[model samples]
Target: MTEQLLSIHELTKSIGSIMPVKGISFELKRGGCTALLGPNGAGKTTTLRMLAGLIPPTRGEIRYGSGDGHTDSWRHRIGYLPQYPKFYSWMSGMEYLSFSAKLSGLSGKEALRRSREVIEMVGLQQAAKRRISGYSGGMKQRLGIAQALVHEPELIMLDEPVSALDPIGRREVMDLLDRLRGEVTVLFSTHVLHDAEEICDDMILMVDGEIAEKGALSELRTKYRQPVLSIDVEPGEREVAWLDSLANRPYVQEIELGKRGAKLMVTDMGVARAALIQELADAEIQLLRFEAGTSTLEDMFMKVVGS
Candidate 1:
C-alpha cells in the first residue's frame, strides 16, 4: 500500500450564517496527484485554504505524516498558491523567487541558489531577469509555481491553477504540472473536468460544500460507466417521428433530443445498437450519423453536481 501524506477528518468551516465546507474528509497518498474537483461555489477554495493553514476551520482535524496525532508543524512541509496570485510588478522573476524563498526561511545565499534552481525548473530561466509586469499571463503563473517550489516543500497545493489561462497558457501550465507528477505530492482544485481527467490519478468531487463522490479516477469511471448511443438523422417528418418514439422504448433509459438528433442512455449497448439500426433500415430513415459508446467522467460530474 502507498504511504499516506495527509489525512483530513470531518473538516468543517462556518462563517457566521454560511458554511462553505461541511464535514469533509479525505486522504492524500504520498507522491500522488489528486484533483479537488467541483463546480463554482462548491467550497473547493475554502477547503484548500483551511488545509494551507490560511484560515481556521470551525471544527474537525487535519493530520500530517504517518502518525495519528495532529500538529500545526506541517505548514513547513507544504507550499500553496491561491487561485488569484498577486506579484510585485516591479520585481524580476528571479528577485521575486529569491525574496519568497527567504521569507520561507532560507538564508540569503541559499535563497538565491534555490530561486535560480526553481526558475529553471519551471522553464522561466529565459525570462528570469524580466520584470513581472512585462511577463505574459502564462509566465506569471509559471512564476507563481516557481515560488511555491522555492522552499522545496514535500507537498504543493494549487487552487484553480489553470482556470483563468488562455488555451496556450493553460496548455503550458498543464504540461508543467504533468512533469511535476511523482516529484512532489500535488493537490489542485479545478471545475474543468477535462483538466482533472488529463492529469490526476485520484479525485475528490465536491458539491455544495459536501463530497459528492471520491475515489480513484479509473475506479469512478468504471463504477459510473453506462451504455450510450448517439443518433443523428436528416430532419424530416419520418426521422422526427422515429426519434420521438425512442424515448418510450424499453431499452432506452433516458434520452435528450435535438432538432437533428437524439442522445440515448440505453440499458444495453448491443441490444440498443442492433434495434436502432434495424429501425432506421426498416423506416428508410435518412441517417447522418450513429455512434455507440460508454459514458465518461463528465457524465458522472453532471449527475453529481446537477443533483
Candidate 2:
C-alpha cells in the first residue's frame, strides 16, 4: 500500500480575528494530484501556508506523516511554491535553485547537480544564468517550481501557481504539473474550475472557511448523476406543455426549461427517450433534434454551490 503524505484534522487558521480556514480536514495520499478549489479570499492561501509550516495553525492539527527531522531524511522531501513567488533581483535562476538545494541539505556539488536538473525540468536551462529580475511572470513562476523541486521532494504543494499567467503560460505550467503526475504527490490550490477539471484526480471544494465538498471528480458525478436529454422542437405551446408534463412521469427526474425547448433528466435514459419521443410523435410535434447531456464539473459546482 502507498504511504500517506499529508493529513489534517480540524485545521483552523484565523487572521487577526477573521477566520480564514475554519476546520478544514483532508488527507493527501502519495503520488496523486489533489486540487483545493474556491472563490476569491476563500482561505486557500492560508490553508497552504499552514501545510507548509509557514504559520502554525490557530487551532487543530496538521500532521506531516513523512517529513520529520533526520539525517538522510524525508523532511527535505517536501516542496512548497507560494502563490506570488519572490526572488532576489541579483541572483540568477541557477543560483537561486542552487541555494534552495543547499538549504535542503545537499552538498555543494550535489546542490549544483540538482539545480541543473531542476532548471532543465522547469524548462529554464536556457535562461539559467539570467538574473531573476529579467524574468517574466511565467518564467518566475516556473523558477519558483524549479527551486522548490531542486531537492527531489516527494510531496509538493503549490498555491495558485497559474494565477499570474497568460493562457499559454498557464498551459505550460499545467503541462509541467502533468509531467509530475506519477513522480510526486501534488496538492495545488486554484480558483479556476477548468484547471481542476483538467488535472485533478480528486478535489476539495472550500466555501466560506470550510470544506463544502470533497471526493474524486468521478465519484461526485456518480453520486449526483443527473443525466439530461436535450430536445429541440417546433414552436408550439402544446409541445412545451406536453414536455412539461414529463416532470410528473415516474421515470423522469426533472425538466430544465430552456429558451428554445427543454432538458430532461432521468434514470434509464433509453426508456425515457423512447417514451418522450413517442409522446412527441403522437402529439405531431416536429422533433428538430435530440441529444444526451452528461453532467460536467461546471454543472456540479453550480449545483453544489447553488449559484
Candidate 3:
C-alpha cells in the first residue's frame, strides 16, 4: 500500500457566521490525481484554499506525513494555484517565474534555471521575455501553472484552472496536467465534469458543503446502474416492434425507435443484457451492432446531488 500524503480529520470551515465546509474529511494519497467536483457556490474553492493552508480550517485537524515516517517537511512539498493568479504587469514572463522561484526559496542561479525550465514546460519559452500585460488569457494561465510548479512541490492544488480557458486552451492545460499524473498528487477543483472525467483517477463530489460521493471512477460506475446500451440496428418494422416489446421489461426504462434501430434506457445490464442477446438470437434478428452506453458526468453530478 502507498503512503498518505495529506490527511484531514473532521475538517470544517466557517465564514464569520456561515458554515462553508461542514466536517469534511478525506485522505489524499502520496501520488495521485483527485478532482474536487461541484456546481457553483459548492465550496470547492473554499475547501481547496483551506486544505492548502491559505485559510486555516475553523475546526478539526489536518496532518501532513506525521505517520508516514518521512523526514522532509510537508509545506515545502505543497503548491497551490488559485483561480486567478496575480502577476506584475511590468515584469516579463521569465521575470515572473523567476520571482516565484525566489519566493519559494530558490537561490539566484537555481531560480533562473527553474524559471527557464518551467517557462519551457508551459510552452512559454518563446514568450518568456515578453511583458505579462501583452499576454493572452491562455498564456497567462500557462504562466500560472508554471509558477505553481516552480517550487517542485509534490502535492499541488489547482482551483478551477480551466474555467476561464477556451476549448483549445483547456485542452492544452488538461494535457499538461495529464503529463504530471504519476509524479505529483493533484487536488484540483472544477465544475467541468468532462474535464474531471477525462483527467482524474479518483474524485470527490461536493454538494451543500459536504462530500456527496468519493471513489475511483470505475467503482462509482459499478455502484450505480450499469451503462445504458444504445443499439442501432438496420431499420425495419419487425425490429421496431421487437424493441418496443422490450420496453415492457422491468429493466428497460425507456425505448425509442426511428430510422435507427432503437435507443434503450436500461437500468441494469447484468441480467437484462444476457436476456436481450438471447431474445435477439431466438427471434433470428440480424444484429447490426451493439454497444454499452453511459450517462455523462453531468448526469452523475445531478444524481449524486439529488438536484
Instruction: List the RMSD of every prediction in angstroms.
Output: 2.8, 3.6, 5.7
Candidate 3 structure lDDT: 0.82
Name the weakest run of 10 consecutive residues (lDDT summed) in model 3.
66-75
- Error of model 2, residue 128, in angstroms: 0.9
lDDT (10s digit) by residue, model 1, range 1-307: 9999999999999999999999999999999999999999999999999998999999999999788645467777889999999999999999999999999999999999999899999999999999999998888999999999999998999999999999989999999999999999999999988888999999999999999999999999888788999999998999999999999999999898999999999999999999889999999999999999888888878877877
Backbone Cα, N, C clashes tallied per candidate: 0, 0, 0
- Candidate with top lDDT is 1
Candidate 2 residue-wise lDDT, 1-307, digit = tens: 7687778889998889699999989988888899999887779999988777778788887666665432224457678998878798799999999988998889999999999998899899999999999988788888988887888988898999998799888888999998988788899999877888789898999888899889888887687666788888876887677666768888777777765677777787888888887887788887888898676667767755654
Q: How does residue 134 of candidate 3 score in lDDT?
A: 95
Q: What value of lDDT does candidate 1 attain over all alpha carbons? A: 0.93
Lowest lDDT sum, 10 consecutive residues, model 1, at: 68-77
lDDT tens digits by residue: candidate 3, 183-244: 88888999867778898888888888898888887677666644677776666777767766
The segments of candidate 2 whose C-alpha lies over 4 angstroms from its true place after superposition are 16-18, 66-76, 102-110, 217-226, 232-245, 281-289
- How many backbone collisions does model 1 have? 0
TM-scores for every candidate against the unseen true structure = 0.87, 0.82, 0.77
Residue 54 of model 1 has an lDDT of 92
Better of 2 and 3 by TM-score: 2
Error of 3 at 128 (Å): 0.6
